[model samples]
Target: MATPLSAERLLTALRDEGLTVHEYREWRTHNRNAKGPWGPVHGVMVHHTVTSGTEASVRLCYEGHSTLPGPLCHGVIDKAGEVHLVGHGRANHAGGGDGDVLAAVIAERELPPDNDADTDGNPHFYGFECVNLGDGQDPWPAAQLLAVERAAAALCRAHGWNHRSVIGHLEWQPGKIDPRGFTMDAMRDRVRKRLGVPPDGGGGAPEFEPFPGAAFFAPGRSSPIVTAMGHRLVAEDCGRYQVGPGPEWTSVDQESYAAWQRKLGFTGDDADGIPGETSWTRLKVPKS
Candidate 1:
């Protein structure tokens, strides 16, 4: 059993794991804590939205159906690997689940078949509703699957839990078959491997470098990674220089990246010739 991480910490953890997160309106405050307890958390629960269209699915997860109330899950992982945070505590996603399953998760052991619904899982698990049709044929894109693995791994790393701490909705509850088209055990293996690779290149807890936010591109700061970003900018046909987007950052590189941002339709301060997080991520600059 573990205390729930604060909302701010959860966001930081996910980002540190290299997952793209988008905070929805009032997401920090959105939760089902008024109805029940939110902690003594044991694990992370993964689910499928049975829905298409990221925006609609995210909204639905944030605002549940009339019978169920709202704050269905903590986050909605979309097809493009973007995680839209919807709620923070005691979400409605995981209902009554098997006590045996909870025991297994807590022990970090192999899960037994979920044959009973005797435990309150909402208070025990962090939920992530991934967008999918649940039709079996709907594809799970590589990026989306990576997001799922990273999201789950980030939580497990935080709690010092192993792969067994991650489970699918179907694995936790009876009469529920969400998160189809992929095996939970396989996903856990992926999470396990991620946990082995330290974020800072040290064999310990992750110490990720900050994401290249807009502030990272402010004048006077220099990094060799700037050259990689310049190459990506040139490839995208946004280059605006006489020559050399060399190993150093220059006004030309900033202007070119800003033009790329404009091509992507950002305006005003957002497009003020600076590299913001979203645009920088979309650019996918290679590691230096």
Candidate 2:
């Protein structure tokens, strides 16, 4: 499909959405060629500058930090909800995430785990970094969350994607926190509701499953037991993984489970690859 809107067109569209627009001095060229199809854009990734002022956040994203190089995102949303376009094509945000999740977003299916930055996310996702502390203590101003929701909704509408396409920086990165305070799931929930998708993980009945204390896992249609287990782990601070307790499990989950094998001391490799048994034993779970 053709590009939804040119930078100029996007600026106009954003303005129509009631957001103030600012064009950064050092942004990606509007006509720059992209690596892949701009259509089928699965979703939008929300981020926090983790910096104080909008100017500083803009400069950092435009110039990039020492660790990330430069041009870290496509747009920067300020405290007042003004959106500043930084880069257009492949703006360097979105490292690796689970391919399954990417596909699910594209298909408008329920999302799975975001495993790695292995794929070229920049080509497929529009990135936005909002100016906020993301320290969890910093309350998400009503304006900021509104801006995020609007921005995400606009992008999803343009791309024909549902709110499930919306996610957070923390959701993509393991051992890293971002856009804190508000949960990624919660943010997506608002988006989903707005888009008219069933907020309860789509039309599929939620499966309750146990998640091993692993680095990541993805749940699919199955017993609510497995779904409940995975949900518990995510709630208790487990990274998102795209393994359904039934099948399509990856080696990573196995590694994650084996690493914590000793946590289930008496258990054997039974917990090594499965998302149950020993791995579940290691988890400090609350009664449901």
Candidate 3:
């Protein structure tokens, strides 16, 4: 088995991975955490450009969008999955989120719901921005997906964290959505699978102890599920925890479940699993 990649070692690996590397001194820091460990990092966060090409996305990540001053992420991964380091140490990526979620992620505990963007995730997460349209229709090439998996798995190996720690940008923010079609849960699954971890035994997303309303919980029924799912799935290393069968729940009748859920309008979280609305819906189904 290979060793995990640290932030410093990650640089060498990216260089070795055949990607042009650039260091932005204008966006570097030491990240003083009064309440956390300074090493053995937790996990990786994946995102989509929502911009067009690789170069453009890279420039945007370094330059930042109008809403966010600049230096939006730590790295920009191209459509080919080649990583380009942008900023390091507290880059302006993950904003506010559930503190329990962050704590669980750091401890590698089962994730909890990210009800709001109230925490500073950038301080803890290693962000990666991949080139994609973010339109939910962009085709995720195997090469790009593989690159993401490699990068994430390498980090997991380094930090002693399972692939479950990895998440997506959309999962962190409330009204924001990037890294669309490729759900965080799906991404984590690939990373774990690559690391020789059995898909089932690995951690699942944190439980939303007190689930929201029926409409809020049901797939296609509310917007919160996607955001909520993104939060839980990434921490648990599952894909968006949507209501029915989807890419996230591969152990079950995946194809049929996804088909049914999509028809109901749930893109990420509103699908099935154990308890809660998704489970209720699935439980209601007649056993084959």
Best by TM-score: 1
Model 1 sits at a Cα RMSD from the real structure of 13.2
Candidate 3, residue 137: CA error in Å?
1.6
Candidate 2, residues 183-261, lDDT tens digits: the string is 8777877766655555454622112224433444443323334433433333222324554322334454345444445
TM value for model 3: 0.59
User: What ranking of all candidate models by lDDT puts the best one first?
Assistant: 1, 2, 3
User: Model-by-model lDDT, in order?
Assistant: 0.82, 0.61, 0.58
Q: In lDDT terms, which candidate is top?
A: 1
Candidate 3 lDDT (Cα, whole model)? 0.58
Give TM-scores for every candidate, taking all chains together and pairing residue i with residue i: 0.69, 0.62, 0.59
Residue 108, candidate 3: Cα error in Å is 2.3
Pitting candidate 1 against candidate 2, the one with the higher TM-score is 1
lDDT of 1 by residue, 47-126 (tens): 99999999999999999998997798999999999999999888999999999999988887788999999999999999
Model 3, 106-186: lDDT tens per residue? 665556666776776756777787888988888888878878887776566433457678877666666667778767777
Clashes of 2: 25
